[model samples]
Target chain A: GPKVLQIPSHQIIDMGQMVTLNCDPVSNHLYFYWYKQILGQQMEFLVNFYNGKVMEKSKLFKDQFSVERPDGSYFTLKIQPTALEDSAVYFCASSLGDKNTLYFGAGTRLSVL
Target chain B: GQQVKQSSPSLTVQEGGISILNCDYENDMFDYFAWYKKYPDNSPTLLISVRSNVDKREDGRLTVFLNKSGKHFSLHITASQPEDTAVYLCAAGARNNNAPRFGAGTKLSVKP
Candidate 1:
């Protein structure tokens, strides 16, 4: 089974600070996605990226959030000036293409204080 | 509104019994449906999936039945074992877009 590895399984940061969550998707995968899950809640879609561009994003994807996969490297989600409400487990996923099975990472738990 | 929904919050079944988990979606454009199993403190893993082209798909003791007309789908596990206890999450997605919307998940407890 292909694996999407997320770095720093747990991250604690102060509010108003910038934080970057990295994901190493399957080597052959082309589509990338990010999901947010708050405790005791459903997994919420944040954004999806393909061909180095963002394809679709949900309302949960705030203006302070951004995503990029630099030169075929690790895909990253950067939050500039984070807020307390941003505390949640962020899961990264990748798939071969649309209509394909998606591989997900273990999720990076972000705790904002 | 939740595009995908799992009405059941939890279920319990005896070993060797059949476990049926149901899910529903509100989107008509969704062409792909899948079921994911998640253990405690672990990431969700793909168990089985089916596209709208078919009504039913079977893999060993696991079966996925899709009812597109009703906007619903289900995952049925036969000869259920205690090891099968976990949280089941249903998801739906479209063809051109890869971001799948997941349900709230239903927790299953297979008692021996």
Candidate 2:
């Protein structure tokens, strides 16, 4: 099975600070996605990127959040001036196509104190 | 306003029995539905999926039944094993959108 790798399995940052989560998707996957999940809650969709552009985003994807996968390198999600509510486990996923099955990484837990 | 909803928070089943998980959705435009399984400290993995074009899909011990009229779907795991214990999430996606909505997930415990 193909695997997606997420860096920094755990991170603790002060509120109002910038934090970036990295993901290495499958080599041939074209569609990338980011999801957030708080403890004991459902996983919420954040955003999806494809072909160097954002294909779609949920309301939870605040203006402070941004995603990029420049030059086919590690896909990154950056949150600037993080808020207390931004603390959650962020999971990165990718698929060969929009309708294909998504492969997910273990996840990066970000705690904004 | 949850577009996809899983009412059951948790369920326990005896090993070798059937495990059924249910989900309902409010979106009519959703044409694709999938089930994902997750263990603690792990990300959700795709278990099974079905398109609106089909009412049911089966692979090995897993089966997904979709009722478009009712806007509902379910995952059935037959001959459940203890290792099958995990959180199951149901997700739905519309053809025109890239983001898929997910349910809260049902934590299943297969008792041996």
| DockQ of predictions, in order shown | 0.78, 0.79
What TM-score would each prediction reach against the true structure?
A: 0.98, 0.97
lDDT of 2 by residue, B6-108 (tens): 9999999999999999999998999999999989877888998888999999999999999999999999999999999999999999986456789999999
Distance (Å) between predicted and true CA of B105, model 2? 1.0
For model 1, which pairs clash?
A: none
Q: What share of the true interface contacts does candidate 2 keep?
A: 0.80
lDDT of each residue in B3-112, candidate 1, tens digit only: 99999999999999999999999999999999999999888999999989999999999999999999999999999999999999999998677489999999999999
Q: Candidate 1, DockQ to 2 decimals?
A: 0.78
- In model 2 chain B, the worst 10-residue window by lDDT is B93-102
